[model samples]
Target: MKYTREILSDVEGYVPGEQPKSPDVIKLNTNENPYPPSPKVIEAVQALPPSALRKYPDPLAVELRRACAARYGYDGEDWVIAGNGMDELLALAVRTFVDPGDAVLTTYPTYTLYETLVRLHGGRVVSVELDGAFQLAEAFYSTPARLCFLPRPNAPSGVCVPRAAVERLCAEFGGIVVIDEAYVDFAEVDGEAPPHCMDFPRRFENAIVMRTFSKSFSLAGARLGVAVARPEVIAEFLKTKDSYNLNAFTQAAGLAAFDDYAYMEANAATIRATRARLTNALRDMGFDVPASQSNFVLARWNGVPSARQIFRALKERAIFVRYFDAPRLDTALRISIGTDEEIDALLEALRAILG
Candidate 1:
């Protein structure tokens, strides 16, 4: 007999981007920061006490929350909560708000992990299909779910929905809306004052914004994410979160990284520049490249050497990019912007493959 819950009988697990072992491979599959973490973060990690590992981490992550709250202009530590990663925080949101047989809403062809998380909680997934331009359909506002997760500058496409539209949705949707802004840092990196949805929680009582230290902060390996919400909502999230989810070392690293904001901003500026160059290069090579606000661009080959063929050919040449076989994404490869050298290598490999 199977020793599994009824929900497990037909559920498919989330598939993370591949992490190949070969050091020589030019990996651009996962949206990891090609740059190293801030020097201060490295110093903090190096300074962690070995004895701290023997004790439990602060369950509330007070200092880290304070730093984050200050950065976002939040009133107090009660408005923020840290997680092992955005993945964990997403899961926690589902568990806290979605009951069995309840509904979870999101856009079709999003992060994909959102669907898996809802299914794992035995919640119904109501996916709103994006229109021909990959924009959210009007019906999205009417979705009656217990919770909704929306990714700005959505994945697999790298297109950002307008801030006004998101605000309108938050005003219309009855239930909780979680704005996943894992890539918002990229969109606003070069702007003098980029509009962030973090303030949505204050405006609409039912909204929350999620962020990560991975993409723009160059801390993918450190695995830190946080949620910004109203104090009352954060209190409930704290009730659902696992104790000691953020370890002592990670807290130290996050604090150090947050302290050195200028360093992270410089790296983000570099990525923004590289992303623009990469998008233009792909378009020049006859690929359908969209306007990307994220660190990655989705390039689709409409004719010769389809996406799958190009993906395989690049892998053979020790270059890696992400190719999804799902609907609406089968013909495109999502390429994360690496260093200038790496982007040049990928472009050269693509040229050879196309020829």
Candidate 2:
């Protein structure tokens, strides 16, 4: 009974977003792409012969990495590594770079999984809280940690840090800096290009940028995520990740999804449009909604019905959204941008509840 480690006995684990099984639920609590994956993904999965499962999958996921690299101007598999999901890669980053009793850093109110991963490795967490504008504080640069996890277009709040800020951080930080761009595809940052930090790896040897097929590519259930960095860092990650992390089917599906990039782009465009409409509607209804660059909006209204009341009211109506019960986030609701129909339903529900 006492065989478990002391840390395991005392630590509270990370809680995932709810996945209600009911078909009629609006189901927007997690930021899953409401759109389906490209037709190619479906075809690839269907074409996978049953016999292929007989053997162990390719340990390196060579072809899938190459295909993903081609999109970002990387030369070969040496620059990237795939994982079961971003969660796995996050853990891998901790294992590969952080030592027991070392420190890992990230912004406060970010993806909580970073802390969990660090804790699992017996590393300490150094959280730098964002300021009144929800941007990184000037003092953030001074916090020293061995590995830094920065989510560009951060989660929960869905606000991305500026490119210059990131460059400065990478320049000054002594250790590794990972720009988690899991939601970057959904962001149209400069009006001309997709919001991303992929090029950072080339600019700074200590920089690593990670992406996932879950959001824009509609492969959340597929559990596919990739990270790009210089060859040396990538080699370290390869040593840390599981040998068969990317199974045969996932590799196939990811390749097909990559080949059909246009499909994902179109869906991302639709999501951006819906996000704009939803944000405007929420603001019009007296909610303080931030300018979201990701597929979700963080809204807080202090008037009539509080955020918690609205969360409960919506749940009673079979509509689901994310409401954090922690400090700095208790008053806000992170609502994922669903399809046009789903957004309409949510808006109608909110209108009725507030009225």
Candidate 3:
């Protein structure tokens, strides 16, 4: 009757925020792009020949790799590996780099997936909790923790850390440094570049920068993620990955996304503007807002209703948003910025609730 590992008796696997079945819900929960992808994505998918689908997708995924390399500021496709999405890439990294009993370090109240991924690999997690202001500890630089997983403009709270911290970690930590930039483009679109250690991979040996097409590129359904690292590190990851990780549809769509950079840039700008406006609007309405650099905002109320109560109230109004029960983030709600209309609806709901 007892088949589970002893370590898993209490460890809960990560539950992604709700993707409610009702399309009527104004989903500001998971930070998904409110905009549609470029018209070219539609054109590319439509243009895909039936023959491509019949074939097993390209194992090397050459074209996707090239596009990813260019996106990450690398000159060639040599060290870029695309996965089904960033989530898969992270799982592969843990499997490829970590052996049982090997410890990996991450900041808690960051990406919950890192804990699940490492634990599944029989690797122990060493975590430094977010500081008083909900930032990663400065001690991470002095402490040589193995294989740090960092989320830029970290989720659940859009507060960003300086890039110098990542560089310092890479310099000091002997193990790998995977900088997960799922929200980086959205942050940059918001006019904040909190420093990324992506360039260090080419110069030093242990750095890896990862990205996804799901967020800024508005291709969540595409399920594509790319990792940029030294060629050798990428080779090691390739050994761990399933051959056909990136399928034909994703590759084609991603290429179209890269090619239609102007449309992508415009959408990013609109999202940025909306993020700023929503943050200010929420703050003005008496919510304690974090300085958000992502497409989402973390807001705690000014001693009105508990975060849980507000979340439930919003859900009752047929609008969906994120509410976390974890200790560090228990008192706040993470709200993704949607379109102007969506924001207006959310604000209207908040006003009604407060009154």
Stretches off by above 4 angstroms in model 2 are none
Order candidates by lDDT, high to low. 1, 2, 3
TM-score of each: 0.98, 0.98, 0.95
Count of backbone clashes for each model?
Answer: 0, 0, 0
Model 1 TM-score (2 dp)? 0.98
Tell me which residue pairs clash in candidate 3.
none
Q: In candidate 2, residue 191 scores what lDDT? A: 71
Residue 299 deviation, candidate 1, in Å?
0.6
Per-model lDDT: 0.90, 0.90, 0.84
User: Per TM-score, what order, best first?
Assistant: 2, 1, 3
Better of 2 and 3 by lDDT: 2
* Model 3 residue 18 lDDT score: 86
Candidate 3 C-alpha lDDT tens digits along 256-348:
998998887788778878988998898898888878777899998646688888899999999888988878577888899899999999999
Model 2, residue pairs in steric clash = none
Evaluated at residue 316, the lDDT of candidate 3 is 98
Q: Cα deviation of 226 in candidate 2 (Å)?
A: 0.1
